[model samples]
Target chain A: MRTKRTNWLATCFLIAGSVFLLFPLYMTFMLSIKDNKEIADSVLAFPKVWRWENFITAAEKVNYWQKFKNSSIITVLTVTFTLFTNSFVAYAIKKKFDHKFFKGLYFYFISAMFVPFPIIMLPVVKLTARLGLDNLYGLILLYIVYGLSFNVLLYVGYLRSLPQELDEAAIVDGASVWQTFWKIIFPLLAPINATVAIITTVWAWNDFLLPLIMLDQESQTTLPLAQFIFQSKFGQDTNLAFASYLMAMAPLLIVYILAQKWIISGVTRGAVK
Target chain B: MKKNNFGIYLLLVLPATILFFIFHTIPAVMGIFYSFTDWNGLKPTYKMVGFINYLNVFKDKDVLDAYLFTFKFAILTTVIVNVVSLCIALALNSNIKLKNFFKGLYFMPYILSMLIVAYIFNYFFANFWIDIMGYLGIEKWMVNPLGNEKGAWLAIVFVTVWQSAAFNTVLYLAGLQTISEDLYEASALDGANKWKEFWGITFPMIAPFFTINMVLSLKGFLQVFDQVLALTGGGPFGVTRSIALLIYKNGFSGNEFAYQSANAVIYFVVIVAISLIQLRYLQKREMNL
Candidate 1:
């Protein structure tokens, strides 16, 4: 009976906690639907009227398609470059036990994770301008390099745990090293690659700074930058701003909710392994 | 075959290595190097102005405040994220019916772009929850969590805790799973109470996980930018300026490239020092398993 009481208490605590966590997101949906006057007056009140046009207005104001295109290009480019480099680097490091150079390379890459981005944010922008990489291509290049370590570590761990039987089997069948990796090892890498792609996509899609620095030209700004513009332009119109924000997030929220399971598995597996 | 394998390794690493050298390593090295100079980040002419930049960094009371605030913010977020993560993990780890579904829901924030999460909270903070509080008949406080000083910190912490707790909970869940079920059986057999079982068996088994999650949260929190930008914008007279946001302003907006680099260097050092200490401490406690 005592245990039952404590268990009930625990269940309540857990439920309350989850609800509390969900509250912020729940309120966001509510605020987005309310008009501005109602916002200040009814801070927590139910919407007197759901102005569905707000979303339509937001979509038009932000030129939603172009921003989406920009973000898509950036995300695709980043994920490709990041995965390629991360896998390549991990392959090199995985070959290390007998090779001192490989060991040094591994350490070099691992140490990169320690340096915070704020330190280099200034100088890197300068260098980008100097190097003429201060454009779409430049932004892509920058993310690939800076974001390599964590992804590389992820690949290295997964690769390290891979069995040698596959390699030996391929070799016995007279497959070349390149062939062995591409035709054999790379296929086995699909799951980790998906994980890497998903993680990088989330990071790239949300990235505001690198593009903010590199893509100063109006035509070049990605979705987040465009969202920034929409935000400031419509700042005084809270209802409009909320609408824009909601529109901006709609696709991302959908994609995430859909992929949340695959992502969780990948993240936990990546981290714990 | 062996010689060809070495050549292949070289081939694979080259493209990434070149990019890594250009974008990450050199810039970081130059970030530290240029902090001592008087470069505006654009003009051709520059001079190595020793100690002046660092002196200016220290002299700027705003930067100092940002430092203290960022440190407190990172430390607080890391601690809270871990604690809340542990709690959610324990809850989820229990025999719940809708465990995976709830885990999925909780982790939704972590997967959503920070931009989206920030926007969601930006609205949640200013408008809706307050209304819910009213409906529940406890709307007296009506404080906008993201508005004022205390409230801003609270809001940021709350948002961060909420969003990140799920991520860490997954980590803990994975860790919890890895803890030999036998350990619990052993504890139960020994008449160890639940709390004692947790303290002894559960906590220690997830040693490496603790270290990894701690480091991940530290690095993640230390680089906070989006929430501050979206939610507070360092408003109410600049109280919410994180070190990352501070660096962004100084670098991109403030036109003090060299000075901003100094700020970043200082930020980097603080992060590395803290991480190194935490890693070492965790490593010391971790068992051979």
Candidate 2:
């Protein structure tokens, strides 16, 4: 009887929380299908006529494909380079623990984590502009650089647990240091790599302020930037704006739903550590 | 072999090293240095403005309001997010069916862009919420909260906590899973009620996660920008503005780049001090425990 009561209470809490979590998403979809008249009439009511063309109009109005491509390219490159560079640095730092520079380098990255972006963001933006790096490629480089410290921390912590014998064994078998890392250490660090990859990818994908400042061209605008511009221009058109929002958010939402298990686990583990 | 190893070390480390030097290290040093200057971000010339910007930060009503508002937002968000997430974590941690489903649903918002989330909620606050309340015949329900000064701050807090609680829920759930089931069994055997069992057993064990959630959410809330920008655009007389928004406006939109750098420096120090204090307090608690 006690167990039954606890179960009932837990189920009730779970249902309430789930509704809270899911409401906005449902509303977003609902609003996307309603015209401005329908929205003003009854924003909470179901759409009388599903306006699928709202999406078509929004897509045409904004440079949806261009911005989407820009975001995808930047995210992919940022994640790939972040993983490769940070993992390699982690391997080197871990393998060369006795080396004075590696020890200093390790501590340097760790301390760097404490320096929040705003502290450095202004100067870095100015400096990057001076270097003619105020573009998408430069933005990727900034992401890679800025992304390194935290990821290196994650990788270093993970690498510490892996047996040092792996490196020694590879080196003894005539593998170079580079080969040992790329061929052996890198593969062994896949789990933590997934965590870093997902976290960094999400950050680089959702990042707005940097792109807003640096990516000045229409061609360079990311999806979020484009959405911000679109809303400011035509935000009164609720149907079109929501449709554009859905278009901006759907790809990531779909990917997350399909790969939720891995994403959730990665995020939880990443945070707890 | 030694020569090749040295080359490999440089190759592996230099990219991150050089980039960090340019991007992270130099800018950090320069942020403080520039705070002492009058570089307006456009001209190549400026004079050293000693302590003027810092003085202005304190004297300026808007900047002080930004700080106060941010503190209120961060403190409230930290408390609400942790409590809500902890409750959800406790419920989900129980022997509930569809546990994974609920967890997934809760964390769904964390992955979506804050801009997108704010935009969606902006629509609801501007239109749907008012319409629903009017339909229910509630007096003055037509007034949008995001359009009011005080209410807009609440709207920002709500959206922030809503997105963040999911992540904290995941963290707390992970922390809860670490507590041994045997401890709970023993508590139940001692005739401890649910409240006692939770306060005695579950809460203590998850205290570290509580600290983590508090510090992280506080830090994130202090830097709140994308959501505020999208939802209110610092509207209703900038009552919803954050320090980060102030930094962005002063640095980019206005010509007070160096002054904003001063603001950023102060913001950075405050964050570091607060985080360090929290960590020290939590660590001391752990020791006491």
| Model 2 docking category | medium
Off by over 4 Å in 2: A1-6, A98-100, B1-7, B131-142
* DockQ of each candidate, alpha-carbon based: 0.50, 0.59
On a 0 to 100 scale, what is the lDDT of residue B185 in model 2? 78
Tell me each candidate's RMSD, in Å, in order: 3.1, 2.4
Candidate 2 lDDT over residue span A1-273, tens digit each: 235344778888889877777888777777789888887786668889998988888898887888899999999999998898888888888777788888999889877766767788788888888899999999999898888778878888888887877778778778888888888888888889899988888888888988987876888999999998988798778778888888988888888899998998887777666
The per-residue C-alpha lDDT of model 2 at residue A144 equals 89
Chain B of candidate 1 vs. true chain B, TM: 0.92
Per residue, candidate 1 scores C-alpha lDDT tens digits across A154-198 of 888898888867776776678776677778788888888888887
What TM-score, to 2 decimals, does candidate 2 have?
0.94
lDDT of 1 by residue, B218-260 (tens): 8888888877888888776788888888888877767788888
Identify the runs in model 1 with alpha carbons over 4 angstroms from their true place: A1-11, A34-50, A172-174, B1-4, B128-147
lDDT of each: 0.77, 0.84
- On DockQ, the candidate that comes out on top is 2
